[model samples]
Target chain A: MSLRLAVLGAGAVGGSVLDLAGDYGHDVVAFADSSSSAVDPAGLDPSAVHDRKEREGVVGDADPEAVFDADYDVLVEATPTTLGDAEPGFSHVERALGDDRHVVLANKGPVAERYADLRALEAESAGTVQFEAAVGGAIPVLSTISDLGAPHVTAARGVLNGTANFILSRMAAEGLDYEHVLAEAQDLGVAEADPTFDVDGIDAALKFVILANVLSDGKTEYALDDAEVEGIRNVPGTALDLAAEDGRTVRLIGEATADGVRVAPRLVPQGSALSVTGTQNIVQLETKHAGQLNISGRGAGGPETATAVLSDVSRLE
Target chain B: MSLRLAVLGAGAVGGSVLDLAGDYGHDVVAFADSSSSAVDPAGLDPSAVHDRKEREGVVGDADPEAVFDADYDVLVEATPTTLGDAEPGFSHVERALGDDRHVVLANKGPVAERYADLRALEAESAGTVQFEAAVGGAIPVLSTISDLGAPHVTAARGVLNGTANFILSRMAAEGLDYEHVLAEAQDLGVAEADPTFDVDGIDAALKFVILANVLSDGKTEYALDDAEVEGIRNVPGTALDLAAEDGRTVRLIGEATADGVRVAPRLVPQGSALSVTGTQNIVQLETKHAGQLNISGRGAGGPETATAVLSDVSRLE
Candidate 1:
C-alpha cells in the first residue's frame, strides 16, 4: 500500500523526500512550509509539487493549518531544529498524532528536547512516530538498536557531529589550528555560519540523548540538559598531533550509557571505527550478546537524510 | 511472549544460546547434538542445560530424531558448516520449516549451499527463516538490510572471514608471513586446526552468497560455486609493507553486486571501514538512496554468534 504523505518544511531535506517519494512508492499529498502550504486530498503529482517549490518558491497558497485536516497517512516533519520549545515542529507533530497520522521526523528538536512528551503523544494516539533521519542522517542507528531490543544494548557511542569531526580531522592532518580549519569548513559549506550547535557539542549531545531514549525503549527520558556536553571547540591541534604520533586520532565522540550521556573530544586509535573523519557519522552499539556493532555513513545531506525519511515510511508500512 | 526454541546443535554456539536464552525471555525447549538430544515441552532450565553440556559432554540421552517432533516455536540451527551437501543442517532446517516452525540459523551450509531451496521452503511454509548468525556472528547485518527493505540495497561488500582477517591483520601489524600468523591464530583458538574453508576464502564466499541472496530479497539465488573465490593464503608480508607505504591495507573482502559475487584480497585504505583488523567483520551496503552504510563487528564466535541467533528470535517477534 502506498503511503499518502503530508510534508512540513519544504526545505532541502523535506523537498528531497518529495522528490524521492514516488521512487519509494509513496505519494506526497500535502506540503507546507513556514510561509505557505498546499494540499491535495487525492494525490499531488510529486514532480509538479517539487517544481512549484523550486521555481515558484512556495508549494501552494493553501493555509498552513490545512495540513492538520489534509488527507495524509503519514506526516514528514523536516523542520529546522529549535531546542527550547521545539516550536512549530513539536506542535506539528502533536497535531499530526492527535489526528491519527503516522509521523516520520527529520527534525531533531521534537525528539531531543521533548522526548517524553513525544512518547506520551505516541502512546495515546493511533499513529506511530519514526525519526531515523533525526540522528545520524541516513544511518539506521535507531532502528538497529530498537531491532536488537532494549535488553541487548549496553551503550551507544560515535562521531555524531559531522562539522566538528571535519574540523578536527583537518586540524590533525594539516597541523592547522582550530580557527583555521573551522574557517575552511565554513568556506566549504561543511559548517554553518553559526557553527555553535555543531562545534559546541550540542548537536552530538542531542543525538546521544535521542539514542539513549531509543536504547531505553522509551521507558526512560532524557534531555539536552541531562547530558554532560563538551564540543571540540577547545580541542587543541597539539593534542591531535600527539595522538596521531601514538597511532591515534582525536574525534568528537558522543556516548550514551546506562549511567549517563556525554559528548566530548576523545583520542581514538587511528584505525578504530570511531576514528572516522569528515562529514561521516559512526554509531557503535555495545550489545551484551552481539559485541560491538559499528555503523557509519554520511551523517547529513539533503538526499541522504531524505533517504532515511523514506526508509521510515517503508518501516511504517 | 516468550519463544520456545529447539536447538539443533549442543556445541558452543548452541550452548551459548541456551545460556543466554532466559535473559532474552526465550526458553530452550529442546536441544540435540550429533549423538544425543533432549526435550522438555515446559522449557529447559538454561543454566542446567549449559552445565549438562559442559560437564557431562552430552545434553541428553534421547536420540537426535527426538528434536524433529519437539514442541517449539523456532528451530535454532547451530550445526557445523558442511558446504557440499549441507547435510544434517539442511535436513534439520527443512524439517523445521515443513512443520511450520520458525528457523534461526547459525549454520552457513543451509544458507550458502542451498539458498534457492531454502527460499522455496520458506515460500511454502507459514514459518519464516532468519539467519543473522550465519554470516556475521553478533553483527545485525542481515536484519539491517532486511529492515531497510531489500529493494533499497544495491550491493554489499565486507571482510567476512574472521580467521582469515585475524591472520591477515596479524601479518600486517607484525610484519609476519601468512604461515606464521596462521599458526599463531590457531594457537589463540581464533582459527581452526584445519582451516581450509577460512584460509581458502570459502568462508567469506559463503557469507557473500548469503548477503547477496538477502540484498535481492531472496529473489536471486547464489551458492558457493557462483562466487569467484580467492583467499589470503598467498598474501606475503612484503605486499603488506608495500601497501602500508601507500597508506593501504590488504583485507579479504567479499563483495556481491548485480554483476557478480566474489571473495578476494582487496586493498582498503588504512582508515577505511573495510580495513577492520583481527576477527572483526565489516559489511558495507551500497543503497540506492541511503548512500553507503558500513557495519563492523565480530563475525564469528560462540557467544557472539549466539547473540545473532537470539536477535533473529527477536526479529521473528
Candidate 2:
C-alpha cells in the first residue's frame, strides 16, 4: 500500500506531509515549492530536503515542472489556496488526473471554488480524489459523512475556523473586545498578520461550501459566492457578556445544507457539544435517521493537518 | 444493491430495523420473535407483520427456527444482550457466518463479551461482522476507529450510556438527589423497571470493553470483568453542587486504552466538550498524530440504533 507521492507546496502543511510521509509508509519521490522542485525516482530524504530548503532559498536545483515528469502515484496538493482560478493547484490536480494518478488535496481553492470542475475531472480519470485535510484539520468529517452516506446526512454545522473560535472563546473568557484579542492572537501566532481570511469567515465559508457540494452529491454545485457569511468582527464583547449572563456562550458556527452554506457567530448553550473552546473545532451532522453527531478536534496545525493528509494517502487504492 | 434481511428478536431495535429496512432499499424476507416468525420469499409487509404480532402475540405462525430456512443475505441480530455465554445471539451470528452470510449485530453481548470468538468466526467466513450499533447506539464510534486504522488511535474515552447520563444531567441541573432523579427518570420511562445494568455502569463498561477490543485489533481481549466499573449511584446532589461551584460538573466517564478499560463518575469542566447534557453520548479518541477527535450523539433509541444497523447493512459488499 506504499504510494509514491509528488507533494506540491512547501508551506507548513506540505513540509509536514513530506516529513511525516515516511512514518506512514509512503515515499516522497518528487517535491516542489513555488519556485523550486526536487525530483527523484527513488525516495528523497525528508531531512535533506528540509535542510536544503532552510540553508538555500530553494528546495533543489531542478526546475519546478520536473515534478510532473517524475514517477508518482499521487499528487499531494498542499499549495496556498487561491480564490478565483484556483491556480496551479487546480492545474496540478488536472495534470495528475490526466495522467491517471490519484490526488490528495490540502489546498481548499480547487475544492471550494471549483468543486464541479474538480469532480468532472475525477469522473473522467481512473484516479480518485480525496481531500480530508481540506475541511476539518485532523477531524474525520468528510470520511464520517462518506461512511454514513451523504444522502442520509441532512446538514452539517459547527465551529470550523480555529482562529475565529480561539479569538471568540478568549474574548468570552477574558471579557475583551475584538480589537484587543486580535492583537493578542497575532502576537501569539494564533492569527495571521493580515487575518482577513481567517477572521472574516471566508475560511469557514469555503469549508462549508465544500461540505455542501459533498452532501448534495453533484445534484447542486456550491461555490464560496453562494454562501451567506458573517464574521466575528461585529460580535462585540458586550454581546458575549449578555450571552454569558443568560448562561450561554458565543461560537463562530458554520452550517451547510443542500440549500446553501452560512457562517456566522451564534450563541450556543454553555457546556454544550458545540461550545468547543480555544483552537478546537467541531462539526455537528444532522442525520436523517440517526440523531445529531458532533465531531470536534484540533482544527488547524501543521502536524494536525498533516495527519489528515497522511490518513487520506493511506485511504487511496 | 438490495439485500435480503432476516431480522431476529421483536424488541425496539429489531422492530425498528424491520420497519425501516425497506426504506433503505433492503427487503426483509424473514423476521422472528422467541415464539414465532414471519417468512416470505417475496418480502413481508412490515405493517402486516406488526399487526399480526400485536393481535396474535406472534410475528407469524411459522416456527421461530424457520428463519434459518428462509433465504437471507444478512442476519440482523437485535436480540437482547446476555452476558457470559452470550447465547442465542452468538449462536445466531455463528450460524450466519457459518453459512458465509453477512451478520449485522445490534446485540452487545456477542461483541462485548465474546469479541475474539466473533472475529475468529469472521476470519474463517467469506462474510464480515459489523457491529456499529453495539456501541454508542447510533454514534459512529467503531467505524471511525476503523477509518483511522486502530493502530493510529491511542485511546478512547467518553460517555457511552444514555440512561446513566440522563440521570446524572438531571441531578446536576435540578440539584436533586440520585433517588429523586432515578424516580423521575423511571416515571418518564427513561429508565427501565430494572435500571441496575445502566446505573451500575455495566452498560457503559460493555461498550468500552468493545471499544478496547476494537482499538487493540485483537492484540488484547477485554470482557466485562476486565473493566473497573463505578456508577453514579453514589454521586449525590451535594457533590454536583460542589463541583458546579468551581466551574465543574460530574459525568459518568469511561476510558479504554491498550492497557485496560475503566468507567467512573469523574469531574469535568462545566463547559468542556466532555460535559454533554442529558441522554447524549460522546467519545473522545486520542489519536497518535491527529490529536483528540470527539464524536458525540444519541447513544440509544429504537430508530437511532436502527440507523446504525441499516448503515452497517449498506456497508456490506
Candidate 3:
C-alpha cells in the first residue's frame, strides 16, 4: 500500500526520505522547511523535488505553513532537536498528530522531551507515532522492543552516541588526551563545533530517555533530568591506557533499566559485544525469556536515518 | 490479541513455548510429539503440561496425528531438522499452511530446503508464515529483513552456527586444536554428540540459504547445495595465531550476496562486529540506504529459541 507523506525539515534526513520514497512505495505529497514549502494533492516527484530544491533555495513556492494542512497519510518531522520544551519541532509533531495523521519522527527532541504529550495526543488521535530513527539511526532498536512487547524487556544498554564514541575510540587507539581527540573529531566533521551536546552525554542521555519510554510503551516516562549522566570529557588518556592493560576499552555507554536511565563512560571488555568502535551503535536488550539481544549499526547519518524513517512508514498498517 | 496455538514437537523448543506462552499473552490449546499428543481447547496450563510430560513421558494421551485435525489459529513447528527432502517438518508445515493456519517455524529444514514450496503455500493460504527462530534464534533477524522490506537489502553476512563458533572461540582463546576444544564443548553441553551439522558448515550453510531466500523474499530459491560450503574441521590453530599477530581473529562466517551464499572460516579484525565470541551470532545487513546494520545474540538455546517463537506468535496479526 502506498502512503502519502508530508515531510517537514528538508535537511539530510527529510531530503533523503523524499529521495527514497518511491523505492519504498511511498509518495511525497508535501515538503517543508523553515522558510519554504511545496504541496500537491497528487504525489510529488522525488527527482523533480530534488532538482527544485537544488536549483532554488526552497523545495517549491508554497508557504512553510502549507504542510500543516496538506492531505497526507503520514507526517515526517526531521527538524533539528530542541532540547528543553522542544519548540518548533514539538509544534510540528503536535499539529500533525492533532490532524490524526501518523507521525514518523527523525527529530529526537520532541520524543525525548515531550513523550508524555505525544502519548496523550496519540490516545485521542486516530494516527500512531513511530520514532525508530529517533534513537539509533538505522538500527531498528525501538521496533525490536515494540515487536517483542514492552513487558518482556528487562533492561536496555548500549553505545548510543556516535560523536562521543568516536572521540573516546580515537583517544584509546592513539593514546591521545580528550581535547586533542575532540579537535580531531571536530576537524573530521564527526563532532559539532560546540560538541557539548554529545561530549557532555546529553545526546546519549536523551536517546536513553527515549529508549526507556519506548521499552515501557510510555508507561514509564523519563525526562532528561531523570538520568544520572556523565560525559567522556573527563575521561583521561591514562584511564584508557590502564583499561587496555586489563584487556578492556572505554566506551561511552547509555543504559536504561527499571531503575532509570544512565549514560557514562564505562570500561568494557575489549572483545565483547558492547565494545563497538567509532561511529557504531549497539543496543543490548535484556529480556525475560529471549536472553540478551544485541543490535549494532551506524547510529547516525542522513541517508541511514532516512532509511529508518522509511522502514517505519512501510510498517504502518 | 490472543492466538490459539497447536504446537508440534515436545523438545526443548516446543516445551519452552508452552512454558512461556502465558507470559506472552497466548494460549497453548494443543501440543504434539512424535508418539503422543495433548489438547485443551480452554487453554492448557503450562506448568500442568510440564508435570504431565515429565510423569507420563508424553505430553498427553492422544494420538500424534490428532494435531493435524485440531483447531487452532497458528501452528508452531519445532521438529528436528531433516536434510535433503526435509521430511516430517516439511509435511507438518504444508498441512498447517494448507489448513489456512498461521505457521511459526522453529525448524530449519523446511525453510532451508523448501523455500519455494512454502512461498507458494503462503500465497494460496489465508494465514502467513513467520520464522524468526529458523535463522538466528531470539535475535529477530528474519523479521528485521521482512520489516525493512527485502528489496532494500543488498547483502547479508553473519556468524550463523553457535556450536561451531563456540568450539572455534574456545580453540582460539586457549590456543588449542579443534579436536580438543570440540571435546571440551561436548563435555560442557555446548556441542552436540556428533557435531557434524555444525562443524561441517552444513548448519551454517542451511541458515545462509534460508537467509538468502528471505532477502530475495523467496523470489530466488537457494538450497544447501547452492552455497559454497567449507567446514571449520580443518582450521589449524597456527592460522589463528598468525592472524592474532595482526590484531585479527578467525571466525566461521556465513555470507549471502546477490551472487550466491558462502560459508567458510575467515579472518576478521579483532575488534570488528564479525568478531563475536563463544556461541553468539551476529547478522550484518548491508542495505542500499541504511548503511551497515548488525544484530547479534544467542543463536541457540531452548528458551532463547522459544522466546523467538513466542515473539513470532504475538506478531501474527
Evaluate every candidate with DockQ and list the scores.
0.74, 0.73, 0.77
What are the lDDT scores of the predictions, listed in order? 0.88, 0.92, 0.89
Q: Is the docking of candidate 2 incorrect, acceptable, medium or high quality?
A: medium
For A139-244, candidate 3 gives per-residue lDDT tens digits of: 9888888788889999999999999989988998999999999999999999999999999999999999998887777677998989999998899999999999
- Please write out the lDDT profile of model 2 over residues B1-317, one tens digit for every residue: 99999999999998999888987889999999999999998999999999999999999989988999999999999999999989989999999999999999999999999999999999999989999999998889888888777888999999998889999999999999999999999999999989999999999999999999999899899999999999999998999999999999999999999779999999998867788888999999999888899898999999999999998999895
The CA lDDT at B43 in model 3 is: 88
TM match of model 1 to true structure = 0.97
Q: Considering DockQ, which of the candidate structures 2 and 3 is the better prediction for this target?
A: 3
The residue-by-residue lDDT of candidate 2 on A150-170, one tens digit each, is 988999999999999999999
Q: Rank the candidates by DockQ, best first.
A: 3, 1, 2
Interface RMSD computed for candidate 1 is what?
1.3
Lowest summed lDDT over 10 consecutive residues: which window, candidate 3 chain B?
B211-220
Fnat for the candidates in order: 0.78, 0.78, 0.75
Tens digit per residue, CA lDDT, model 1, B28-89 = 98998888888999888877766776788777879888987888999999988898779978
- TM-score of every candidate relative to the true structure: 0.97, 0.97, 0.97
* Per-residue lDDT over B1-317 for candidate 3, one digit per residue giving the tens place of the 0 to 100 score: 88888999989899999888888878889998889989988888888778988998888889987887777999999989898889988898888888999999999998899889888888999988888898988888888887788999988998999998998888878899999999998999888899999999999999889989988876689999899999999999888889889999889999999988999999998878888888999999999988888898889888999988988898886
What local lDDT score does residue A185 receive in model 3, on the 0 to 100 scale?
91
